[model samples]
Structure formats: C-alpha cells, structure tokens
Target: MLLLATGDVIAYSYAPGRPGFLSGAELLRALPPGAPGAPGTPGAIAVDVVAEDVMAEPSWDMSPSTMLELARRARSAILERGFDGVVITHGTDTLEETAYLVDLLAGRAAERGAIVLTGAVRSLDEPSSDGPRNLASSVVAAADGALRGAGAVVCVNDEVHAARWVAKVDATSVAAFSSAPFPVLGRVTGGRFERLSAPPPRPPVFAGDPASDVALIKTYPGIDPVLLTAVVDAGAQGVVLEGTGVGNVPVELFTTIAELTEWGIPVVVASRCRTSAAPLDEMRHGAGLATRVGAIGARGLAPSKARCALMVALGTGGIDAVRDWFRKL
Candidate 1:
C-alpha cells in the first residue's frame, strides 16, 4: 500500500493532553512488520509512506486547493510511481468530498490501480479508537487486485463504498458513512477484500483546480429569495440549491431562478431528501417551474456533490459547458 496521510482524527495524539503527538509516518512505523501496511514480511503488503505536513489540518479546515493537491499526489502515485494501489488517510468530516474529487480527477486512469480513502471517527487517545483498524482495512482493500478500476472508494467500518455515492451520515458513530440508494461496492473482512458490486466507469471531468466561488443553499418553507441574490451579489460563480422532495422549491423563487439564468449564473437544483433523485419534470409547481425558468436538475447527485461538480464544470468551461456537464450526470 502506498499511504498518503493528509492528517485527521487518525493522526491525533495517542496520549491525552498532548496535541500533535504523532505524525502519520510515526503511526505507520508503529505497525508490526507482518501487519497489513508494514514492511519486511515475506508475504505481507509493503507500505510506502508519504506525509504532507502542510496538508495535515483537520478535515473541516480542508479547502479546494488542498483537495486538488491531494488528488494530484494520489494520481502521481498510481500513474508515475508505479504503485498498484494508493490509500489516503483523510479527516472523515470531508472524506467523501475529497474521495469524489479524486475519483473525478482519476477518471478512466483509475483502471490502472485502486485509490482508497479512510479515516476514523474517534481520535487515537479515545477509548476504542477505530483509526488503526480502519487504516488496516483500507490498506487491505487497496492492495486487492479486484478493486482496480473500481474508481476511488471510501473504506471505513470494514465497508467499501464508491466515491460517487458515499456520504457521512453520522457525526460520531464508528459506522458514520453510507451509500444509500446504492449498494456498497464491497467489504473488507478477515484481512481480505470481498467484492459485492462494481461501480460504473466515468470519464475524467477536469484536471485543474475547481472554482472556489460556488454557493450551496438548502431551502426551507417560506425561505427568502434574498439568500440566492445575496450569494450572487457576493460573487458566487455558481449555485446549487437543495430543494425539497424531488427537487421542489417554493414557487416564489422561480423568478429569481430565471433572473440568475439570464445573468449567466448556473443554478442546479438537487433533492434535499436522502434518497430522492432530483427530477425536474416530477412536479408542476416547484421542480417543473424551476426547470421551465431555466434551473438545471441535478439528476441523482446529492447537493454537496452537485456543488463540487458545478465547481469543476465552471472551472473547465463556459455556461454551455456547465449545462452539458450536468446533462451527463
């Protein structure tokens, strides 16, 4: 396993009252020789560690630039360094987002090897810390040949999820992530990967830094339209609206959506419901009305992932290009 540690709960102190007590390299070194990610064992997977201290911040502090950099490094490890697989230790807070970004960047090149991300819900000092076990499982999964071409995946709590569908559904549970409305790709058990499904292949979207000025809004009953205008006024390059079931928003926001389209700003409507895919023609008032007014339906994408996709689209091309990109989704 080629381990790239970007820091998070997994790298926190093993002793209470001591912050930054351990580096990712140190954590890997602590593993026994015959362990999943350790070296010097006759048949064990050899681990190569790369620790980027600059990116060693908490997941909430993660930014687009950092994510792009991580993607680049992971891509390099696979395409240039000749690694069969790359495993990343990321903060769980934004692990899904980073995993998706990596998947988008990796594109079809993912067929060459496996790219897996994992993190822990509890810090090392906490009782029953899940970091080591999760990391081991991720390493095991990455090294498995069956996962090649599986695209980027998040391996946590022994479950493997495709990057496109995984979401952090719990704040503190060890089993904090899920890929609802989509079955998990597989699982890691007894130090082996068991494949249950395969993820559909996707072409690479863009290779450059994503635009940072995108805005995401979740609508509620009687929500003010001023919120949309406020973001545009503040120079948001694009907007993703998390509407009610089936991507419905209040009829009051229709005019605003039209005006934004006229002004050349892209407005993508996605469902706020956990499992409902946003379908513009599903209703006449909210989703259909917004569609008629020029809002783009986000298809099956979650609001946050839609925002990431929009950012990548806007960075790569013009309004027409953004529309075409969403159309593929």
Candidate 2:
C-alpha cells in the first residue's frame, strides 16, 4: 500500500508486429484517481511510481526516462512514509533485464521493501485488459512483501517470476513471460497471493556493458562459417554458439569458432534448444574437445540470459572470473 510504482513505454518492436510500448504517461493519468478499490482500503496504501522512459534503443540497455526520479522517490517514500513496498511498470521488451538491474543497483534495499516489475500486452485502450490487474497485484505482492527478497520480481498475468529468468517469450499472450530454469514463486488467483514456492538466494549478477560486442550463433541446416566469421571479424569479444541438440554445431562452423577461440576471443558453448547445454561430458573430440580447450559452457541458461551473462563476464576482471560467474549463475 502507498507503494511507489515505476512505468515505462517501449519504443521498439518487441515482438513480431506491434512494438513494445510502455505508455507510462497514459497509465499514470488513468491510475483510478487513486489506488484501486475503495478509499482508505485497510492494510494497504498505494502510490503510483512513475519513472523515465527507459529507451532500450536496441542492442543496448533500455531504462525508463523517469528512472532516477523514480529511484529518488522510492527511497524517499520508503524512509519517510514507512510504506510496505514498490512496484514498477516496465516494457516487456527488456523488463526482466531492467528488473534484475534495479535489483542489483538497489543493493540490500531489495530486502527492505518489495520492488516488483509488471508489464502489459495490449495497449491501455484494449478491453478485458490485464494491465490494471498486473499493476494491482504487484502492489499486492509488495504490500505482502512477496518481493521482500530474491531480488526484484516480474509479476504478470497471474504469475510471479524472478526478474533474472523472466522474459517476454510470447509476444501477445497475457502469459508472455515464462520463468525458465526456475519455478514460479507465486501467483494471483481470486484476488490474493498464492505462493507456491519461496525464492532461493538470488544468483550473482555481474552486469557488463550492454553495448559489448557479443553475438550468439545458432547452428542450423546448411550452416556456414562465413556468418560466424563475420561476427568475429566484427570485433565480438565473445561468441555464444547456440548449437544443435546437446551443443553440436555444423562440423564446419565448429572449426571456425574454434579458430576464433584460438585468436584469443572467448567462445562460449551453449545450446539452442531447451534446458540442455554443450556436452561437457562428451569433451572427447571435435566440438566437445573444443569446449575443453577454452570454450565456456552456458549450462542450461537460455540464449538471451546467457548473452547477458557473457556480456557481464566480459566486463569483469578476466576469463577465470567469467567462468566462475557463469558456473555460479
């Protein structure tokens, strides 16, 4: 209650057709003249948390324009009003990324009050919408301290997920995000919090420059080394091969990647499908052994999140640190 909420409007094509528009100004203006429900709702105080438009602007970190203002207000609101928590409205395009970023940036204040991230599918103009519900639940979750630990959370379409694992997998479904490699921490059913699992200790996050030159290579039929070689020539600091099942790539492309590794660039081996990773157990020859030489394994991480981890690793001290960070995450 009396929670601080942050909102952003996406300015890019987040999915197939329509762009991910945060529409913060519109939502702020439509905030029910006050928090949802009757006046003086007991045990809950609600406040809209508005932040700047975080224009991801593509291949870069997107942050709301009102981010700093929101942060200042959040710290002030919590310390001054003795409120329960904070809720954020972010674009699904980079919502998870931003959520985890804020979680780390906010430090241990993460444990002090709930900081939940929520987003919408249709524009606010649509009917039978989920925006209001999602926003309300975030406040509810925060007020209930469902966001008290495990870093910032992305609460949407009745599902509560960790920011680190939440991604806009589906472009249009209300249930756009899925918490892969993790379980749903809770859900909103019948207007109340239904926690199925408590979050584990949040994984370590070493944020690298979002602009870092990193590319993920997904092996496919007729795969050619020319494309991968192009990425390496483009000055990619790292390469993530989204190889075939069990981390096998075109035998031809594998050699190219290996050659890139030999050139001192870090080549990370990951899988393109499912929760599988490069066959660390099969590091006997070919790509398997190439992984043995210097390739880092993304270990069950989705390609997007793996890319994030790799960027962070590249920004860190060195290769060993990067390897340890990946293993830990």
Candidate 3:
C-alpha cells in the first residue's frame, strides 16, 4: 500500500507560537513501516510513503488546477506501481470537493485498489491533534479488501464516508466530517473496518480536461437578477443554483434561468437544506417554475458536488449531457 502526502499530512510552522502542520518528510518519518491492519495497530504488509504538494499551503488556498494536477499524479502512481490502495492526506477545508473530483476521475480504478482521503481538524501541534490516528485509520481502510471498487472515500475521525455525500459541517471538532441522507460506508474502530454499506461506483465523466468555467449562484432573499446575468456575461459556461427548500429559486429568477437555458447554458438546481433530495415536482410555485424553465434538479447532491459534476459534464459534452448525468444521480 502507498500513502500519498499532499500537504495536510505534514505539519508546518506557519507562524510564531501557533499550532502547526506536519511536513511531508516529518509525517512519513512518524509512521511505522507496515501494512495497516486494524485502526490501532500497524499491519504486517509493506507500506510506502511519497510527498507532493497539492496546494501552496494547508489553508483554503486550493485551486482547480492544483487539484487536477494532484489527482493526475495520484492516478499515475496507483496505476504504475500496482499499489493495492492509496491513502491521501488532505486538508479538511476543501477535502470533500477534491475527493469528489477524484472519485469522478478514478471511480473505475477502484476495482484494482481503494482511494481513501483523510485529514485532521486539529493541526499536529495542538494538544488534542487527530492527525496520526486519522492517518492510521485511513491506511487501514485503504488496505482492507472490502474497499476495492469503493471509489473515492473520506476516512476521518474513524468513520468512512463516500466522497459524494460527506461534508465538513464543523470547523473545530475532530469529528467534523459527516454524511447525511446517506449512511456511512463503514467505520474504522479498533484498528479494523466494519462495513455498513458497499462503496459506490462512479465512472469518469470527462475525457478531456475540465472546463472549470462553471459558477455557483446561491439564492437569498431579494438577490438581484443582475448577479445572475453578470455571471453569464463574465463567461460562465454552466451554473449551479443553491436554492430554497426543495430546489426553489425566487420566483423572479425563473425567467433568467429560462434565458440561460435558451442561450445554451446549463443550469442545475440544488437545495440549501442538507437532509432531503431536491424534487423538481410542481408541489411548490418556485419548483414548478424551475421545472418549466428546464433547469436540472440536483437530486441528492449538495451544492458543491453539483457544481463539480456540472463542470465536468459541461466540459465533456454540453447541456444535454449534463442533464442526463444529473438525471442519473
């Protein structure tokens, strides 16, 4: 098994007298060499570590280009080295989105090995730092045979969550990541993974590079239509709307959505609420207008995931393809 260190795995001294992250070299040196067996103990199999920077620093400074580069490198290493699994150490801030992107790109490769993402809410210098344990649990989950074909998953705080559904809901707690409206795939307790659900399979969505020109418009009370128009005028190829309950946009924005659809721009509607799926049925006036405007419903996807999927879909094909992809989701 291979453990890929992409910034967050290591602690860095960002400033004087403050908590810090582990450096890649430092983190590698801290781990015991062996296969990850159970959560608390190291396995008997061989484990290797590699360091690469997926971001400039451990903060929320990630770019789409950086994520693509990291994913490409990880994929190459996994395929070329015949590693049984790859455990990625990432920062918690944008881990969910980056993991989803990897899942979209590497889901089919899961048949050969697992791709598990893990990180700490607290830096290594903190008194109650969770990095080492999270790292161990991630390795255990990655090395387990049960994870084969599970696609990309986030293993944090001893819990394994599918990348598509997991969100960072808290900023301080060690147990910050959660999967709602979906049960976790499994948990890593006592140094071993006990499966609760099978890992999901997601095929690659785009053959070429991602367009990366999509925009997310979150609707609030009395938001100006010009904001939506400005996005289009600024060359956004697709848009994801984080609407009110059940995917409802302000009634006034329906015509704007219709215009965008008519102008060949794809629009996806996702709800701000986290619990339920987005139903586009005409049960509400706003949703009814959305249905009429031909905006795609995000189904069970969160806003960020919907944006990523839209970006991939739009870059690969166009409006029709994005609609089909959302329909299936």
Candidate 4:
C-alpha cells in the first residue's frame, strides 16, 4: 500500500493581485480530493491556512525584515505549535530569495520539521493554472518526515530543491525554477516524497535580522568606478560585485574596491555566470588583484544569495566576521 503520512501542517500565502486568487478557506477547497488536507478525505493531514494579507506583502515588495519575521513564525510553528511542517505560497519573482532567507533563519531548528515554499507560474484564471497542484505537492512535501532536517526547500512542478541552490530560471513556464550544478533534493511522486540526494548541512543561523544597506553591483566592460563609490556614498555598508568569469572585474574598479575595504566596507566578489564557484584566486588578473587588496570571493553563491549572506553576516558582526563566514562557505 502507498500510505501517506498524516500530520498538522500550516500554509501561509504571500501572493497578491492574481485574478481570483485563492487562499485560506478557498485555497483549502482547491486541494485535490484524495490529497492531504482536502475536505472529506480520510486520514488527511490537518491544515491551517494563513491568508496572504496576514502573512506578507507581495514577493517583490518583501524586505529582509518581513522575510525574517516569516522565518521566525515558521520556526515557532514547528517548535512551539508542534506542527509537522510548513508551506508558504509566494511570488516567483522573489521566491528564491525569501526561501533562502528562511533557510538561513531556520538554522538548527530545521531539524524539527520541513519548511517548503511554492508558487504559481500562472494565475487561477489563466489556462492550465499551476497554483493548486503546486500547493498540494508542497503540503505533501512539508508533511513528509523524510524532509525533516532538510532545512528549507522549494517545491514546484512536483520537484523539490534545496533553498540554497534553487533559482528562478524562467519567466512564464510552469517549469521555472532550477538548481543547476546541483541535483534536486527530491521529488513528489505518487503522492509521496522520494529523496534523490541529500542537501548539505545547515550553516550557523543568525540571531539578528539582515542589514538592508548592502548593495549589489554587476561588472561589465568599461564599467565606471563611480558606480561602486556612489553606493558607498549613499550609505551602503557592504557590496556584492557580480564579476565576470572566475570573479574577475575591470581593472578600473580596483582602486575603488580597495578603498571600500580600507574604509571597512565589505566588497564581495561573485560570478556573473549561472554556474560554478567564484574562488577569486586568479592572481594574475583583476580577481586575484582584488583579493590581494581585500575583496572576498562569494565561493559558489550567486550575487543575490551572496548579498543575503553578506547582509546577515553584517547584521551580526563586522568585516572580519563577514570574512570568516564567507571563508567557511
């Protein structure tokens, strides 16, 4: 028999402005009849819905403070309310960012229960809407005991990916998210989660909320040095440079990067490419030169995630602390 586990699960929605969007009671009504939490189903999981208006702003409008609060609530649900898992319905635009933030916040508490994020590529009124199916799969993922200690994950199109590596790779396709250079952690098949690969262990969690004064800049041919200085002048406490291959940047920006670090502002270098780690040890070129002057490599993190890590590190400690955190990555 293909038996599915039954437990208490909470679903939080943060998507707004889609036509006839369903959440709360309406969302529960949409779950497939045999799935967990669906009305009239025997042995169904108990689900409580927190509507979008209550939990968050739209994904694009989300800030670090808002995301942190949501993470805290998810943790409380597992540790305090004794819930089996959590599911968040978010906007794809910033879904990866919020998911990653939650992963960071969950930290060691992640071992208690699963935290799964899901969203739709198409709205309810659109042809072949994916929201309801995604939500159902996400709830199942959350309820699965196999997912406990997996940290945060995003479940979409029946695929489960670790929050640390999942990214929004398509704008309009139902198959939108990807975790390239890393395989998915698992998949939802036959109404159950089948583990494919194990995720890496969780990093140390930050007790403080992330800082908002960090800036992310992308380097290009003939990139002006003033762009780096302007953000610092504008009160940016840290910066993540999306540099070229192997984290190289234009030599013209070298002096500005050096100056930022000298002034105690962190300058992290990340690759502009979609895959591979940014070791930044290309000593014969701009990347190595920047490292010599104090720039830190983002390792395997993309710029957006690097910015989140930098913000969290800065929120808790100073430049040396930030350097140490990245060093372990």
Candidate 5:
C-alpha cells in the first residue's frame, strides 16, 4: 500500500558540477548499472508502490505556497493511484518544508499510511552517489509494516524520522538529515525494517490557506527587546521565538512579550539548541519564564514547525483558538 512520489529534475543553487543543474531523469540515466530485482523478490520488501515525479523545476526559490501546490497534486496522485502509503524524492533544500505541506494536505494521514520523504545530499551523477541508497531506503520505509497508520516521515540512509522533526544537518555528507530534540521512529536495514522509538500521535489535519504571514525569530544572547517589540509593531500575525536551551529566554524579553500580549500578537517560545527542545504544556527553565510572562509554550514543536502551526492556527481563528489547536496537534 505504499506509493513513491519521485522528485522532478530540479537543480539548485548549490548543485555540484557544470554552470547549471540536470533533470532528475537525466541524473537517473547517468547512474551505474545495477541488478534489477524481480517483483516481490525474497530479497526485497514487496511494497505496494508507485513512482510519481514532482517538483521538476530546478530552482531553489520556491515558496511554501508553491511547494504546497506541488504537494497537493502529489497527494491527489497518491489517492488516485490507490496507494496506502507514499515516498517522495525531492530537493533536499526544501524537503522538510514540502514534507510538512504533504502531511497537511493529505488530511487522511492514517489511511494514507506512512508517507516517507527522501533525497540525496549528493546527486546521482556524482561518483559518491547517495540517491540509490536513499531511494531504496525511502521505498523500504514507505511500505514498512510496522509504520502502518503513522503519518509522513523522512527516511535517509539508515535513519528514519518524523516529518515534524526531520532536519538537514550536513550539507555534503552522505549521512545527512537528522531528527533533533526528538527521537527517530526507526531505521531501514537489510531490506527489512527495525523500530527504534514509538510513533508520534498524528491526528488528521485539514488543509488551510498558505499565504498567511507567520514568522520565526531566534532569541540570542543580548537580543534587544526593541527587535521583538518592532516585530509586533510591523503587524506580524504571529511569531515563534527560537529561545535558548530548554526554551529559556531573558526575563526582560518576557516584559516585552507582555507588551506584545497586550497588543494581541501571539509569540511562541521554542529553544534554539537541537539537543534540547521545548516542552508542550510543562514549564521548563525558559518556557516557564515565558509562560509566567504570558507568552505561550510552543508545546513540543520545533520553532519552525511551531511557526507553521501558529500560521495555520491564526488563519483558522484567533490566538486562543490557535493555542488550543496547537495543543491538540
């Protein structure tokens, strides 16, 4: 019941080689010859699979909305293809963003089975290719039996992560893309799957408009309160603050946050470190300070993910409503 939504022939600003980039089709043709497997071979996991290419353009300047448009079409393709799960080959640059959008648009995440997103840090044409291994892992991960009922995830190399937490850590290493602050669900191995951590709760999410102006700001040492105060002044609908370890920020920033609360701008607090993450409702060091100061805990969400949640939540309703929605998601 798994489906593979393959990537388009898009090139990026950082792609290796020539003055420009090559198409995914062009790259695939350039790969070394390998022994092809028979259908449902004992050596392979017999995943109900399909390969649908998306994001054919090679530009790095796509917006979240444009990505959403592509995801929606891919989702439709998945449903039309009668797939219970999906895997996508996409540009690593926006893979995380696109994965989030696919989860949002699908709505039926559970019935859609495990949708895995994966791509190469190094392209296929390169001598040290990662695409074949990545694509194999993506296919295997997509049809993972234990992954049934789980939402979309990003599978690269041996590591598998929740789409909500997956981030690209190394630009050039074949072993790139790691899940921070959160644990990975599993890993692909020996044409089989192995579980690492429990699956996250993935409730169904309805699609919403994507043009909303939600922003993310990191709170660094000696960050002036004026910058945050100005963010509210600039009419930003909502802001997710990437705070320090365990969501801690300066108490003075809390005072500015109070001012922001009075102005009706929602500011969320998330930690800046990858190892230490934000807690949902519980007050840790930084989150408690912000909560005590009337700012909200981003609640188990990465700052970027929190920003996306805030944007969608605000578009659906006000801060109060958005807060409740975030809590449940």
Candidate 6:
C-alpha cells in the first residue's frame, strides 16, 4: 500500500505558543506500528510511504486543476507501484468534495487499487488529537481486499463511508463525517476492518481537462436573474443550479435556463436539500419547467457534485451527451 500525505495530517505544532507548521515527514516519523490485520490474521500489514513535502501547501485552497492533477497522480502511482491501495491525508475542509472528484475522475484502473481519503477535525497540536488513529484506520480500509472496487472512501472516526455519500456535517467534532439516507460501507472494529458492501462502479472518466469551466449558482428566495445572466456572460461552459425542494427554481429561472440552453450552455438542476431529491417528472410543475427548457436534472447529486460532473461533461461532450449522462446517473 502507498501512503500519500498532503500535509494536513499534522498541520499544527504540538506545543502551545510555538508557531510552526508540522511537516508530513514529521507526522509519518511520529506514527507507531498501529496498522492492524484482520481478526485472527498472523502478521502485521505493511504500508509504503511516499516522500515527504510532496504537497507544497497544507491548506485546502486546492483548485479544480490541482485536485484533478492529484487524482491522476494517485492512479499512476498505484498502477506503477502495483500497490493494493492508496491513502491520502487531506485537510477536513473541502475533503468530501475532493474525494468525490477523485471518485469520478479515477476510472477503471483505479478500481483495482482503492483510494481512501482521510483527515482530522482537530489539529495534531490539540490535546484530543485524533489524526494518528484516523490515519491508521484509513490505511486499514485502503488495504482491505474486499474494498477493491469501492471507488473512493472517506475513513475517519472508525467509520468507513462511500465518497459519494459521505459529507462533513460538523465543523469541530471528531465524528464530522457521516453518510445519511445511504449507510456507511462499514467500520473498523477491534483493530480489524469490515466491509458492508462494495461501492457502485466507478464513474466513467471524463475525456477532457480537469479544469473545465463550470459555475454553481444556489437559487434563493428573490434571487436575481442578472446573477444567472452574469454566469453566461462570464463564459462559463455550464451551470449548476442549487434549486429548492425537488430541484425546482422560480419560473423566471426556468426561462433563464431556456435561454442558456439556447446559447449552447447546459444548465443542470440540483436540489439544495442535502438528503434527497424528488423526481423531475413532466407531471411536476416546477420541475416540468426545466424539462420544457431542456435543462438536465442532477438526480440526487449535491450541488458540488453536480458542478464537478458538469465540468467533466462540458469538457468531453455536447449538451445532448451531458443530458444523457445525467439521465443515466
């Protein structure tokens, strides 16, 4: 297994009043032999570590281009090293989105080597630091043979979550990650890993640049049409609208969508609600408006995921292909 560090594994210094960033090498050097085997297994599992200081910055200001590059790197390293799996240590902020992006970008080859995204809610300097244990659990999950096709998983606080379903629900708690409506893949118990089920097949990789232009606009009460117009004017290739219940927006927004589609800019409708989305059937009123205008429905994807998918779709295919892709999704 290969362990990659993005420096968030231990960003803060352990001692109070001392101001300095902890290096990835420092974190790795401090880890103990915490890797545990499956229950009744004889030997300790071994993990290969990447060189330190790979990621220049520990912050989460990673752009779409950088994220896509990292995902490609992970896939290449896994294949070249013939590693069973890979673990990435990232910052909690925006971790879920990064994980989901990787899940979509890492195609068939990556399915053979599962990718596990992990991070800590607290800095390593905190007295209640959970970084080491969480990192260990992530390694265990990545190394599990049964999770070969699980796409990308976020393993933290001992629970294993599918990258698509997992969200960072809390800003401060150690148990910040959760998968709702959809259950977790499994959890680590008594120093052993467990698998509930394999994740769905990895999404097809986009045959385009990772930094494809896409914009996300959240529909709010009294949202201005000019804002939507600005997206088109700004030359965004596609737009993701975070609509209200059942992925509906105001009537004017639907007209804007029609205009946008006419301009060859695809608009994907996604619900602002976190848990679920209603069907965008022709029978529904607000949803039907989108259908009348050829706007694609985001199905159950969150706005962020919708934005990511639209970026890929816009880069690789035309509006029809994008609509069909979302329809299948």
Off by over 4 Å in 1: 14-18, 44-56, 201-204, 207-209, 275-279, 282-286
Candidate 3 residue-wise lDDT, 1-329, digit = tens: 66667666335445577545555555655555442522233445434545553444553767777666656655666777777788788888989988888887774466788888888876665676788788878877887889877788999989999988899999888889998767899998866888998655465444666767789989988988778889989998988999877777887788888998888898888887863453565355435468677788877678888887787777567678777766555
Question: Could you report the Cα RMSD, in angstroms, for every candidate shown?
Answer: 2.3, 5.9, 3.3, 5.1, 4.3, 3.2
Candidate maximizing TM-score: 1
lDDT of 2 by residue, 135-245 (tens): 766766766755676567889988888766666788778888997767998987755677887775565654443334678877688987888789878887778877755
TM-score of each: 0.91, 0.73, 0.88, 0.88, 0.78, 0.90
Candidate 4 stretches greater than 4 Å from native: 1-20, 44-55, 282-287
Counting clashing residue pairs in each candidate, in order, gives 0, 20, 12, 0, 7, 0
Q: What is the C-alpha lDDT of each candidate?
A: 0.81, 0.62, 0.74, 0.76, 0.64, 0.74
Error of 1 at 88 (Å): 1.3
Winning model by lDDT: 1
Write out the backbone clash pairs for model 4: none
Tell me how far the alpha carbon of residue 90 in candidate 4 is from the true structure, in angstroms, after superposition.
0.3
TM-score (C-alpha, index-matched) for candidate 2:
0.73
Could you tell me which residue pairs clash in candidate 1? none
Cα lDDT tens digits, model 1, 88-139, are 8899999998898888788645888899999999988789888888887888
Report the C-alpha displacement of residue 328, candidate 5, in angstroms. Answer: 2.0
> What's the lDDT for candidate 5?
0.64
